[model samples]
Every structure is written in structure tokens, then in C-alpha cells.
Target: MIRPVAVIGAGPFGLSTAAHIKASGIPVRVFGDPMVSWRDHMPAGMLLKSTPAASSIDAPRRGHTLADYCAAAGISRLAGVEDIVPVGTFISYGEWFQRELVPGLERVRVVSVDHRSAGGFEVELESGESFTARAVVVATGLSGLSHLPPELAAAAADGPAPTGPVSHSCQHHDLSRFAGQELIVVGAGQSALETAALAAEAGARVRVVARRRVGFGAPPWRQPRLRPGSPFGRAWSLWALSHYPQPYRYLPARTRHYLVRRVLGPLGAWWLRDRFEGKVRVEEIDRVVGAEALDGAPVLTVRTRAGATGRLVADHVIAATGYRVDIAAMGFLSHGLRTRLAVSRGTPNLGPGYVSSVPGLYFTGLPAAASYGPVMRFVCGTEFASPRLTRHLVAAHG
Candidate 1:
């Protein structure tokens, strides 16, 4: 009898890992819809921050790059940083990769994961089916992990679902729904900036509130130059971290945590700056100190950089504050199983090969960022994580 490895997502990291495992001749089962988050969560008309070459799902074999997708699709292939890749194109590329390499991927959701008495994991599906696997990779993307600030989170906790005035940016797909309404978007990151632009474009009265000033990414150079570095950023620290991910695992936890939080802190793409210049109102150096529901709308008390306090009322509040990895928040894990995994703060403390404290259970993607480095947060990280994890799985389980 052969025990297969179970992968819990079909996004870039999940697909990349699954393709590598399949190529390694190991039995693997991939669950979830391909590009589900990108397709469903993000508003239309968004562009990827990474360049075309870097925005690739690592194929066990060659020729599955984003450039290849553009060529095969009869679109002019992107050559340098000048060409921007849209989110829609990337979603199409992911689905294409799944079709070409990772076949028979189950689109069903894993409802629960419990440790078997003997060994391995018993995974129950939403379709009323169950199976045991030698290993399980919890690579589910940003779903169930959207982070809202304490004030907004408290207000959201009282709502039935995402219909509440206070909600995370992840809960929205189309900004057009907020047309002709007043909306306050929190955070200066790409998600916040872009969503604010989209909401304004969709006819919403929008204001962006952030604790710190905004920083936009540099635009592509008029003349393409070959500077060897990581796609993560132009900084040497980012370059080093992207190139040598394994060494990051050996760094002190404090250093690792600092890099994870600061290295990739909030910034919008250069192209988006023009959109927010005149259209969206930006309240920089201001933080949402408190939130309350008044007359069925969200009223936010904000503190300015100068220590002055003010209030702003909006029909909706979008918390683009980003995600925090909390192992206990994973609803699919049984209480007993969740308690068994080790964690530092909300993040799982992963060992080499991306294995968690619990044997044979693994974590990747954003959740792996704290342990593996900042690169784990992006699509390019899959290039490093997939092959290494595949080798580990093959040697240990195959």
C-alpha cells in the first residue's frame, strides 16, 4: 500500500509543489481551485508587482515561464521590466500550467484534517470523502488569514459575514459595489492603494488612511540594464535573502521576524501612483485608533501624525492591513491537531524542508515567510521551495 502526500491549495505555490512532486514520481493529491484567490479575491484590472521572468510557477521541467504563456497565447511576449503583467494574465497562466503539468487536481475543499491514531493524517473533504496521506502540505493561500486591525476586527466580529461595514480588503472582489458610497481604506500597501483607486474609478467617494507615509515602487528604467539581483527587491538584503533562502532558516528568530515585517512593508506599484494622485484622498501619518457602528455605518476615530485626533464616517471601511499567520485560526485543523504544532506568536515554526513541528506536516507560502524569509510571500518563492520540498518528500516518503 502506498501513502500519498496531500497538498491543500492549487495556487502558485501549491501548483508548483504538486508539479514537482508528480515529476519526482511520488503519489500526490492536490486540492482547491487553481488560482482561486487571485481569481476571486482581487479586483479586476490589477497588475502583478513582479516582472514577467520572476512571476513564474516553478515547473519540474522547463518551458513553462510567463513569457512562454504570452507567446503561446499569441500576445507579444514580455521582455523587460517595461512590460507589466496583469493579474488576469497571471491567473490564465496558472490554469494553463495546471492543465499542462498537474493533471487530475481535485477542486474540492478539505473540510478538516485530523491526525490518525497510528500515523499520517486523515483528511476529510467537503464532499463527504476521507483519505489518509503520509504527508500534508497546508499551502492554502491568504484565505481565512486576512488580518484586520483590532478596532475593525472587533466591529467585524459582530457581523454575520462580509456584509458588515468593517471588513478586510480580502473580502472584496469588485470595487464597483461601493459606487456612490463613502469608503475609508486603511494601509498604504499595494492592496490599499490599488483598491482605493479602483473604488474611486467605480464612483465611490474614497479616502485612504495610513499610519505612515506612502512609498511607491520605482518605475521601469527607460533603458534595460542587467543588474544581477533578486526579483524580491533592488536592495542587497532582499537579494541575499532571495538567493540563499536556506540560510534564512538559521537566522535568529528576532532577526527573521524583523526582516519579515520590515523588508517588504507597504508600498504601491509606480503605475498606481498616478491613479491616486488626484482621484483618491490620502490621509498619511494617521492611524485608525477606534471604530464603532453608528447609524449602521462605520465611524473611525483617527489619530494624526501630529497627535491630533479626528473622526471620519464612511459607508464601509476596508482594512488592507495584510495578513498574520495564526496556526490556531486554521479552522480545518482539529483542536487536538492544532495544539500539537509549535508556533512562535501566530506563525508556525517550520524546520528545514518547510516541515512544521508535527512530523510529516508542512507549511508554505506566506505562512512560511517568518521561518523561510520574506521571499516565501511571493510567487517567485515557489522556485526555491518547490524543488527542495519535493526532494525532501521523495527521500522521506517515496
Candidate 2:
């Protein structure tokens, strides 16, 4: 019997996973479009928060990398977002990767998914067509889930009324779209900072809401010992290394999870803090209490940690709030698959191999990131994830 597998999503993770599986010569069907979400969402003039080394999809077999592309074009590689890597450019790279590496990918969306009574899976698409396979892998990026603070919903509903011109910064594209508009940005992460910077350059009067009394770092970092080449190379890469094999499991579960939070969340904030100064106002330890439309502007009642409260008026409001991965949000999930997916804190319970407790079902990307650490979400993890997932799936079917 010919073994078949279905791979969902087409971002870096989905694309890379498909490339690897295809190379293994397994019959694989991939769903979704090139940069479907990334190209359509994300504002214009946005720079990548990650460096070239960390933000690339690993090509299979012969190995053409982002570095190869840059070198071929004589484009110098840098460690930081010194310049914006346009979504269009990345989309182009992804297309080239697909055509040059894994051709014949299915470009339809998985409108719904169903598990066969005899085992395995089937995906029903919007076109009323369904494909069945022995296993399915979900690699959709943050496409299915994003959190818009409940506080902004009412104002957002009011005639698309912006705080001053408020919108979730993710939807922001061309700077020319908001020339001379007053914008209030929320959050201190890369997306928030980049949105504010781009809006400012677009000539918008912008101020960022840094609610933390003291904002966090711009990117997570670590002590010198954790570098990949260091003696305690694992420890040296601490800031960037979200996990460390057997050492992590030996520790108490709470302690292990604590270490993960410290390294991935706060460390990232620390690495990027210095960049926010002057470019945007930082309101540390502040909270958005309530927002109401006053004189056609968003009047946000904010309370600082010091117990002082005030109002901020802006034409628009941007919530750089991060994304979520609850499987329920994925419209494509079938009741059978949903029931089978292991649940831990509303996410799939993933084993060490990145397989869910559901036997043949596998997971990659954010779903596995919690257990696999930050690497699952980064492009760098393809080396570990792709091979592991592909090998396991192939062996089981073979």
C-alpha cells in the first residue's frame, strides 16, 4: 500500500515540513498558499524581528538557504533587522523554495477535517473536495488565532473607529495609509515597536502604551556560557535555547516550565529594550482599564501601577497582543480529530518526539513549542523537527 500524509499550512514550518517529507519520498499532500497569512497580514515597512540566520526555512537535500539566496544576489547578511525584509520578498523566497524544491503542492485550504472510521484522516476543503491520508500534520502559523483585547472591541466596532486611528498593528501595511494620523501603539514587543517606528516615519503622531511601569527587553538574551560553540554551549545559548534535552526533564516540572518562561519571554524582552527609547513614549506599569469614544476619538482610561489613573486620546489603537493555539480555533479540525488530539492546558499534549498522545497524529510549530521549547516556533528547529517527524511517519507506514 502506498503511504500518504497531509500537511497543513504553508508558512516556513509547513513548507519546510513538506519539503522534508517529500524528500523522504513519502506521498505527501500540502495545503494552503504561499505566505497566505504573512503576505496578506503584517503592515508595510515592517522589518523582521529575527536575524537571517534564525528566520529562514531549511531547504531539503542539496541545501539552498537564505544565505545562499543573499550571497547569490550579492546581498549582505546582518544579525539584526537593520533593514525591513518585505513580506513580499519573503513570499517570493517561499515561492522559489516551493517551485525549486517541492513542486506539486496542493494550494487549497482545509475547510474541515475528518478522521476515517478505520483510522487515519481526511480533509474537506472549501471546494467540496476531500483528501484522505494515513496521517495529518498541522503547521499553520498563527493564522487561526490572534487575541484582540476585549477592551478594544467596542471602539473597533464603532464604525471601524480607531483609538485615534487605532487598529491591530498586524493589519497595518502601507505607511501611506496613515499619513499624519495620531496613533497609539500597545505592547513593547518587536511587532509593537516596529509598527510604531513605521507609523512615525509615515508622519503619524505616535505614542506607544508601555503598560508594564517598566517595559521588558526587545528580544530575549542569555549569559555568555550558552553559545553553541561554548564549553557549556547549551547554557551559553540559554537566551536563545528554550530547551536542553535530558537536563530539562530531570528538573521538577514546575521548575522546568519556569525556566522556559524566563528564557523565552523575558529574555527576549531584555534583548530588545534599548531600541524603543525616543522613538516612542514608554508608559511602564500601566493598564488599559476602559476605552470609550469621546468626540470621535478613543478615550482610553488607563491606570498605572502607582495607583494613578488618566485618559489617553488617540485617533487609532494598535494591539500587538500575541497569538493563541487552541485547536478549537482551527476551522479545519474535525470532531474525530479534535477528540483524538491530546489536551494539556487547551493545547495538544505532545510527547518527546513531538507526536500528540493521539498515536499517529503529529504536531509541529507552536503546538509543540511549549514542550519542544521556543525552537519549534523558530525556523531553526526544522533540523530537529522535520527529520524526526518525517522519519517517524515513514517508518510507521513502511
Regions of model 1 farther than 4 Å from truth: 157-162, 222-228
Q: Candidate 1 at 286: error in angstroms?
A: 4.2
- Candidate 2 has its poorest 10 consecutive residues by lDDT at 225-234
Model 1: how far residue 238 lies from native, Å = 1.4
TM-score of 1: 0.96
Give residue 352's lDDT in candidate 2 (0 to 100): 52
Query: How many clashing residue pairs appear in each of the predictions shown?
Result: 0, 35
Alpha-carbon local distance difference test for all models: 0.86, 0.67
- Writing each residue's lDDT as its tens digit, candidate 2 over 158-240 gives 43323344466556566566668777877766677767777777787878786544344322234343344311123455434
Error of 1 at 328 (Å): 0.9
Q: Lowest summed-lDDT stretch of 10 residues in model 1?
A: 221-230
> TM-score winner among the candidates?
1
